[model samples]
Target: VKRFVHISVTNPDIDSPFAYFKGKAIMEQTLIGSGLSYAIIRPTLIFGKEDILINNIAWILKRFPVYAVFGDGEYRVQPVYAGDLAKLAVELSKTSENIICDAVGPETYTFRRLVTLIKNRVGSSAKIVNTNPKMAFLISKILNLLVRDVVVTREEIYGLMADTIVSNEKPRCSTSFSNWLEKNADLLGTNYVSELNRHFKKINEDAGYRISG
Candidate 1:
């Protein structure tokens, strides 16, 4: 490709303790080395219609008594709406400069605040509790088993433990998470939607492609 638009995470560090962050760093490095005129769009948590993170958060809030926040739950998360992320990617595709842009949203919420937001939106009485990282991982596993869906992943738990996902750069997306949730409140968490199910469904539905995995 003559030009590349890579969607990555905000400030991924290769040396970070979390594999998710390290993996994003590796992808960005690989893209930079490919000699393509590239613009990397790093977005924080993304919320939108039928989304994974936000919807799943609602699922847990609606069903559970207590929602676990990893560590002290002070990490700041900046969510960019999916439509905004796509709009940024499209705009970057026409550019030839090698640059990195963060497609964050207008609002920044702490990890605990994010969970609380979902809890409030879902009209749930679940209490937000702080759990140690190791304990959080184990609890996530147990929840996944009980729900028969991925309530949370260890990678996600580790990533959320990051200090902050905010960006000083001007946000590419202007949609507010709070407003979006308010608009889509009724449909956020109707049922279990597996990420793998979403992934393979698209692959299997392709016109001339098949994914065995």
Candidate 2:
């Protein structure tokens, strides 16, 4: 709350890379206790052309031509554009309001549908196959133990699947996913895939191509 324009995700009570919920809860606690003027924004799965994580996932899925859909891919989400969120943040900083608003795209889509949208935008020949939570959990456990990467743990998956569509109580500018995609289709296509490959190469090198016993 200190200065204002305090935007954060709706974190869980527990700690996890899925810690977004917990983290946001703490932030809200701080804001409430701080007694400073503030505006809070909780955005759901913000995406953009140069997004490092979410967009990277989309790009990677496009390149592989095959994707694993965890938990029926029926989870619904409202993806927000990074630019729109950024604008809201700026507005919050300049305006005076002690309110929390959910910043999200106009459309609500299922996880499977999201993949389809990406495929359409990128023109990727990828096939998204339904996957089980057990498999995802196994992969998550391995990654966490081997690489200390908790980005794909069960808790994180829960957030993606079970979390409610962020509320826009305060009301702000809204941007549809289609419009965002139309504006950045090229970036979502081959360009992103190429960049992702280079990124993967660097990651592979940093992790040491192969770990020896």
What are the clash counts of all predictions, listed in order?
A: 0, 7
| Model 1 weakest lDDT span, ten residues long | 204-213
Q: lDDT tens digits, residues 1-213, model 2?
A: 356666777433435445667777787878867888888888877787666555555655665767677789988777888889998888888866687777877787897898778777867777888878788777556644543334365765777777454544443557788777767767753433233343465687788783321
Instruction: Give RMSD (Å) of candidate 1 vs. truth.
Output: 3.3
Which candidate number has the best lDDT?
A: 1
**Residue 152 error for model 1, in Å?**
2.1
lDDT values for all models: 0.83, 0.68
lDDT of 1 at 109: 88
Q: Score residue 166 of candidate 1 by CA lDDT.
A: 83
lDDT of 1: 0.83
Candidate 2 TM-score, C-alpha based: 0.74
At residue 159, candidate 2 shows an lDDT of 73
Residue lDDT tens for model 1, 27-91: 99999998889999898888888788788788888887898889999888888999989988998
Clashing residue pairs in candidate 1 are none
